[model samples]
Target: MGAFGVALILGLNALVGYDLLHQREETLARAREDSAAMALVLEQHATDSLSGVAKILAGVVEVLAVRADAWERGDADVFALLRRQATLSPLIRAILVVSADGKLIHDTQTLEPAGIDLSDRDYLMAHRDRLVPGGANAVFVGNPVRGRTSNTWFISMSRRLEAPDGRFAGVLVAVMEPMAFRSFYQTLPLSGDAVVTLYHADGPVIARFPDHDSHIGLSAHHLPLFTTLLKQARAGTELLDSAGDGPRRILSYRASAEMPLAVTVSSSRDAVLVPWWSKAMTLAVADLAGTLVLAAMTLALLCEAGRRERAMADLQDSERALRDSQQRLIQDIAARHRIEAELIAAKQVSDAANRAKTQFLANMSHELRTPLNAVIGFAEALESGIFGQMSAKQTEYVGDIRKSGQHLLSLINDILDTTKIESGKYVLHQEDLPVDDLIGECLRQMGPLAVEKGVTLTAALPGSLPILHADARAVRQILLNLLSNAVKFTPPGGRIVVEADRVARSLRLRVSDTGIGIPAIELDQVMEPFHQVDNSHTRRYAGTGLGLPLVKSLVELQDGRFVLSSVLGRGTTATVLFPPSRLRNRSEPLRALKRAQPAPV
Candidate 1:
């Protein structure tokens, strides 16, 4: 992190360290005292055993001297050598002697090194006239000097015996390795890192224990403890500080009681520091985790509270809008009722006007028909030459007068039909009539005019045709009018066909003629009252133009329909379609006419 964070962490660790320091005392001195005491106990035991070894070697010399005599007597020395080697005594293992005269003496263990010279050896030279520690007679044990070489590291003591004339004699000696003393000192209770170092006051070491074996002839680590011992030469109790391959160790050390040496007690730092850091980090992580969880829970609660407040405001707005809409709907219903009443009154007035129109048409038709009858009758008789023979010019003028009268008659009839439709008085008396006979009658009436013009007027009636159901008078009038118009317009030597047949559902009545045909634009107009193809053509064809209109009205009255098809100067067909009910009614047998007129002619 940052420098401040580093400093704070160190501060906290120091606080923990300071707390532990106050709880336990620092015991460098007490450790030194205990370790030194234990080392002294082992050293005392080693010194005692060294004294005993000197005494045993003194006896070893006597046994060797006795075994030599046994050899001189030619007796076995084996039993005496066995007694000396049999016991693994804490002091001595073998005993022998060497002479200052440079010759080896025999003993129980001397058979292998016989006749060897010893006067020049260190055992003989160093103790030529000294008294030995074995009560003034100890000899070096296991020493090669004096003809014995078994002692690995030890000193020997010997004394010279003078002749009666005070002459110098050979040395007597003792040998010891000091290994027993070293093993005892190393096994005493001490810290695992402790070291017991033994060195000569001079440069080279005489011997050492604590087999930190590499330090046998070297100085210990150059630590505070070692520096104090070297600089001040103070050998009292003190704390040791050292670093090594094992661990950073704390030590307590003091000089040994009677040896030029020191004993150190040390403990590794791992034994104290590891658990302290573990506890500190455990507490730190637990606190951080608890704080984060609480923060997240608080954020969730605030978000939920905000959502509820917004919902309540929206609900209030919707409730106010609903009440306003209900008030507007009530006012709309009241306005609608008033408009409906006005429409009812207006409908009644329109209906009365239409009835008046029907009445006026019926009355005027009668009036016009009566006067036309007089005019047409008078003009016809005159044209007949009934008032005496007249000039050709007069006959022609009278013919025109008669045609105009008949035309006016046709106009009045159409007006009467329209009035019936307006008044809704049109009725049908449907009955059966033979379709084939019906065509025959229509052709019979129109045949003479066709024959006079030399047009081939004929009926194409199919024998298998059905009876037709319609008002007999109305159906007859429709066909008669169509046939008459066909014959009147057709050119001389042309043809006319009155065809009656059943085609699909309707009974087809087609009146076709080779006539002065209608032009496409004028075809629809001819069906309207007073509308003709053209004025010049109208005067030439001799019709009031109401004939087709009257036929259409009568055909529709029987629930039939009329259609006219024409091509200019070619021909025309007038077809009436009477639906199936009419055809079936015709097939029924008919009784004698209740009311009959002369057959249509």
Candidate 2:
């Protein structure tokens, strides 16, 4: 009986000890996962911010490449452009154009050239000295420094500007404030003693959440993160002691592949182990009570051997319950793993189906266009008497065929364009297009159809309009689609008007028509691809419903806005507003505008 009591005590101690260790490991694993997730979120935020700054610098470089003389001369238009670019994102503190000799030529903050010289700045020096390996165009990210103009700390993302002859002209710098990053970090839902930090590859901390002011601009080279972990991998998690006898922490980090930046999320070891410690204490107390009970049972057994059988049976029952509990835990874990696997598989299948659908639409559209074009060509030939003279009835039938073929072709083209845009394969060919010419071309193409439908078409233009920097074909398509829909829906003798004017900072183009307008509830649905306001089989209008949606997509792709408003049985108006960035300076010279003939009222 004494030997059995001793064995039972040893077994209970082993089981409790094992459970505590397992729980400790599980707590640490969860902490590692949480830190890693937070690190990824922070890393993406840093990447986006840096990428925006880089894009601004690249745009500045491109501008300088073409208008180097104007930029150097502090042209007002160039200054205004710089200011507009700066306002694009809150992350950008300023956009500066530095001369080859390091003189501050101009910045977005002022139109006049500043007397400040930035020759000593690392970003300018790096460009001037050709320190970047990508030659004149490589973007350089410099350490945080106090801005000469703003008198605040900012990090610089700069690119080397080049002359028309490919000579080094100067440096185009975009100033980014660290406070913007810190503000964003503060918004994250972080738990106790967890710190989120942004670091430059050069070892200096750029920003930190929970406000570590002293660490900013300070090198972290002494830490294993810089000395060992960063050298080993671009991303990883580790358990390490914090600096200067601070609490030990589990740190997860990720480095941006496109920029020399890293994000770290760290949680203190004690905070992560809090739940495990509580559980351990409770478990320890329970083990102590059980040990005391077992000791008393041993004493009772020595005096009364009959009680030993009962005690042994109770011990066996407890062991059986523990085994059953462990089996249930294993089964639950397995079920959870299976659920996760199924979810992943479902997502992959959905993505593949979407890709397949897009590809099918693209392929089928192209296939149909080839044969349909031949049919339209032959029909046009017959109508034009290229083959021979035909009877009047035959001529009318050929015209019908030609018209039907053209309509089908248009639908196919819309389908192809929609697929291309959805798949991100469409590229914009932007140029300086006169708004008047774009409107006139679209109006001329759409005029005949409107006239045949007995709908009067007219244009309302301001005295002068700014040149639109956009893809000419896309703008033309947008106008044509709007006008075509107007003509199709308008009753005979109804009027359709095209209007253009400068509204605030945007250029607005509106097409208003006295047509069978859509219901208020269906206006939003009409903007969806292939979604017709009248989708019933007996609908009066004949359309594939791609027109307005295509126009909206094209306008938005150029950073513009599209709005459609209508009232049932009254009228509908389609409005496209191009952003200021897409419009040339109003003061710049433009071609003479031609007034369109007025329609009969």
Candidate 3:
């Protein structure tokens, strides 16, 4: 009986110890998974945000490619463009154009050049000295520096601006503040001592959640993450011991493939082990109680060998206590499983909400367009004197009604078109289209607008050009939107040129206008639906801000690439390149070609 009691005590301790170890491992594994998932989310956010900055820098360079001189001349329109671009992203503190000599040509915050010389800046010197690889379009990210204009900390992203002759023109730069990243990180669902951090590939901390301002811009190159881990892999997870007696941390990191950025998520090991600790404590208490009961029963059995009934009753009581401990242990495990199930269900709900929002947008756009069309038709009839206009004042009022209605209708149409394209409901009606006729008809349609604006509009087409196999109405709309935008933005004496030619087997249609050009930083953003270069409430231009986006969509629907470039205070060029696939071969039978048809909206 004594030996049996000793063995029971030993077996119970071993079993509970093993269970505790297993639970500890399970908790740590869960912590690592959560950290890794968060790291991936942070990495994607950093990549997308930085990629946007790169595109803005490239756009600025492209816009100034033709008229780099305007940047040097301190054009007010150029400054306005810069301001507009800066407003597009809260992360961007300023947009600047620096001449070849490193003098500030224009900055978004000031109407006139700041006259600051940034020749010594590493980012500027890198481009000037041709140290940056990847030609003119490559973006160079610089270490964090205090902004001279805003007196705030910011990192610079810059690209080299080259003239048409391929000479170094200037450096176009966008300054990004880290606060935006920190703000974004705060919105993430992190608990306890968990933290998210954004780091430059060079090892400086760009932003951190929980708002560690002093740590910003500090280098962590000596850390294992940079010295050994990152050197081995672009992404990974590891357990790190803290300095002194602090708890260890489990960190997971991911590096961006598109930019010089990395993100990390770290969770305190103590916090992760909390559930395991509770389970271990309960098990320890149960084991101690069972061991005491077993020892008492063993002693009673030995001392009361003569009293068999009494010894049997004591053993039954010990067995009942052991059964209760086992039941409690099972309940603990069941509770943990229930918590995990709840977490999974919560994630499912979040995903469903996102899908519902997208569907709502599509449905709302359709509902708005139906009544809007009717409003425009009634306004048009009233303007045409069908409602019996009596006086000059009444005529002007009717004209205003029609104009406002048209503008609202245009906005609704753009919204509907965007939704259709996004939902994959937009279809193209392909046909063999005459390049000359398409340009001519579009010009004719836009001639009145150009004349009203007192702007010169002309087309330069080669004597012979291949036919474009595309949706005729889509092509026509693309051309008209480009021309209309040119006319609307161009000054009274400005010139707008429409040129078409063949590059190998592809067709390139370019619309160049001597208008208030777009800021380089806004080039990519302007391609997105309803995004305008000038988005201020009191902006000089009027439209739905959908023309370029619509044109881009239509061009791409036919498998073409659309490129936009502009020079501040000089002009903008919208180029649509149709691939060899979309260019009709002269040898193909025109008789079997489908007639030009309009695509359903």
TM-scores of all candidate predictions against the true structure = 0.36, 0.54, 0.52
Clashes by residue pair, model 3: 60-520, 63-566
Pick out the ten consecutive residues of candidate 1 with the lowest summed lDDT. Answer: 138-147
Tens-place lDDT per residue, model 1, 391-507, is 999999998999788867866876786677656787767666766666666667666666777889777766577766677777777887887788788878888887877655568
Who is ahead in TM-score, 1 or 3? 3
Tell me the number of clashing residue pairs for each predicted model.
18, 0, 2
Error of 3 at 230 (Å): 1.8
Error (Å) of candidate 1 at residue 508 is: 0.6
- Please report the candidate that would top lDDT against the real structure: 2
Question: Mind giving the per-residue lDDT tens digits that candidate 2 earns over 336-424?
Answer: 99999999999999999999999999999999999999999999999999999999999999999999999999999999999999999
Q: Give lDDT: candidate 1, residue 540.
A: 67
**Residue pairs clashing, model 2:** none
Q: Write the per-residue lDDT of candidate 3 for residues 105-144, one digit (tens) a residue.
A: 8877665666678889988889988888787678998877
Off by over 4 Å in 2: 1-274, 281-289, 292-300, 303-306, 371-404, 424-441, 460-476, 499-510, 514-528, 532-540, 552-601
- List the candidate 3 regions with Cα displacement exceeding 4 Å: 67-69, 72-74, 242-247, 300-601
Model 1 alpha-carbon drift over 4 Å, by segment: 1-358, 374-407, 534-544, 585-587, 592-601
Ranking by lDDT: 2, 3, 1
